[model samples]
Target: MSTVVQDRSSAGPLLAKTAIVTGAARRLGSHIALALARHGANVVIHYHRSASQAAQLARQMTQLGVRAWTIQADLADAAQVEALAARSIEASGGVDILINNASFWPEDTIWDMTAQTLQTCMDVHVMAPVILARALARQQREGHIINILDTRVTDYDHKHISYHLAKRTLHTITRILALELAPRVAINAVAPGLILPPDGYGTEYLARLASTNPMNRYGQPEDVVEAVLFLLRSRFITGQVIYVDGGFHMRHQLYV
Candidate 1:
């Protein structure tokens, strides 16, 4: 029931400030891009295969009165990840904010997991963020890097072993990079739970899960978006993972 008090004056032209959001063509990334634009930040939306969707998002951003561009890159490729960072800088003038939201989520039991599946998950969820962060650091630009982590990091689960391991690495980076980036740039994470479920999971499924939480409802994308904005504006905060889970983590079991 807490109201978000956005600083309208601090809304000073993010005019020239640019942000790169990977996997930004749809889902939560799209919401994050729109939220940043609402605060006046120019955005570079990165996509792997959702070309038309990325284009649509860019157009929507323009309508919000901010500059927006779309770039396509397969994050699984190291060279492509490097190029993604480079292109973001080139297209948007200079990357000021980097939201590492691209990830591979596969449903495979530990027994059924393959080496390729594990490696691919690691490449997208762990390595790409590292490469992108390294490239950004080399630019010597004061920036913010927000890695989107899953709420399950605090609690281990074996359902998606590869996905879980890769995301856990991001949590480690959140702390490590916070120290490495130091007084110049800020690095943090927003660990979301049930904001939007994976493909095939519907509202009824979400409601059932939400009923187990103390809040009794699934979180909305705005919840995480607000968390991101808070981290971005709070100069004193960094190296933290703010969970937008509505207390679901406190429950003993998530009744599927």
Candidate 2:
């Protein structure tokens, strides 16, 4: 990382800082990584299977005048998750921001929910975040941790029961970690709503779902990135969830 200090009085307030964003190869994670890099933070882009995409993203981020590294890790694997944090620390010299943006959005109804599938969801949404947070705490003090969450907590998703339950668990974990890592690290979350369509869905699906929000429109990835940036730049805020959803959480509609 370059030690030369530039006048960060500009929009890039996080100049010279380092951030780790999981599942950053594409989609919303990719947008978040680019936003952080645009704001002058060196990024560690974590991916599970998108090696080529991740490398391309790193190159683009570096082209923005910030350092970027790609790390592949299956969030479901505890060992790989741990190794990701370790490698990020070694590569960046130390981590100043940690964004738990990787998640598994499983589609299983209550009757269809199996032990194996439930365990996998829990491993990614709940267990992996806790492990990464603990590792980041050990690597650096006075940093920020942002968990990427969904707006379904206020509503219900019967079709994705296992995934919904795991995310709720992660929501609680965020608050608990905020208390546990207080004064050393500030932890918070950004709950996104209608930001991106699921794997099989199309733009029409998102357009139909947009009615659930009072805004009557879909949100862009930049909305979530702005929420993440707010949490990262503010030192006094912690354990809060900024819903980037277009008032959908307020309506309590089914997201799945």
Candidate 3:
């Protein structure tokens, strides 16, 4: 297990603001939502099928003395993506932050990857995020947008070809959108590596990968949260990809 750091400070850095975090029903998304709520931000926890989990998380966050609600949408659908933003804005009055964290990671080699799978990757990881960012821009003139990316974007993952392709496209999108939405909304990304084990894997899986990381450790969800907070709190930073991957990216071969 990665280091668990529970923030007990009463800072409330995001006081009176609203944040919409996609895939916030569990895992890293849940941690991100609670972190923001802990800082006094009302959170819109978005989920697709985890209805019960989403509601439970919303209730837990609300108990923290902040407003929290859950919204459901299949990110693979364009119309649903649009409705997600609209509903979130309506529920929270306005969205001050957007975190694109939902994704589908299926294990498949390049030879077995299908066009349909690739399209779903693009729809979920790239298209939906673009839609939400644009919608948030329309709703709030000034805010922060943080995309939860994979550290593999800096390297190759033949086993997850389609997933990697979509994430790499998102990596580029983050930079472009940051420039387009600059001076009003700062767009950035946090690339996590060896943080949590992939779905269907155990802690041992991450522990094995951790040994290969330069830091010789696995990262906690809170580490990613800290990077996000730094980006959101900054006034002059935008269009940057912060790797919370324990120096794994530095060791990856860059194709310059």
lDDT of 3: 0.88
| lDDT of every predicted structure (CA atoms) | 0.84, 0.88, 0.88
Q: What would the per-residue lDDT of candidate 3 be over residues 223-248, giving only the tens digit for each residue?
A: 99999888878889999999999888
Model 1 TM: 0.91
Give lDDT: candidate 2, residue 39: 79
In order of lDDT, best first, we have 3, 2, 1
Work out how many backbone clashes candidate 3 has: 0
Please state every model's RMSD to the true fold in angstroms: 4.0, 3.4, 3.6
Q: How many pairs collide in each candidate, listed in order?
A: 0, 0, 0
Q: List the candidate 3 regions with Cα displacement exceeding 4 Å.
A: 1-12, 253-256
Residues 108-210 of candidate 1: C-alpha lDDT, one tens digit per residue: 7789999998899889988999888887877787888899999888777688988998899889988999999877788999999889977677777888788
Worst window of 10 by summed lDDT in candidate 1: 1-10
Q: Estimate the TM-score of every prediction.
A: 0.91, 0.93, 0.93
List candidate 1 stretches off by more than 4 Å: 1-10, 13-15, 252-256
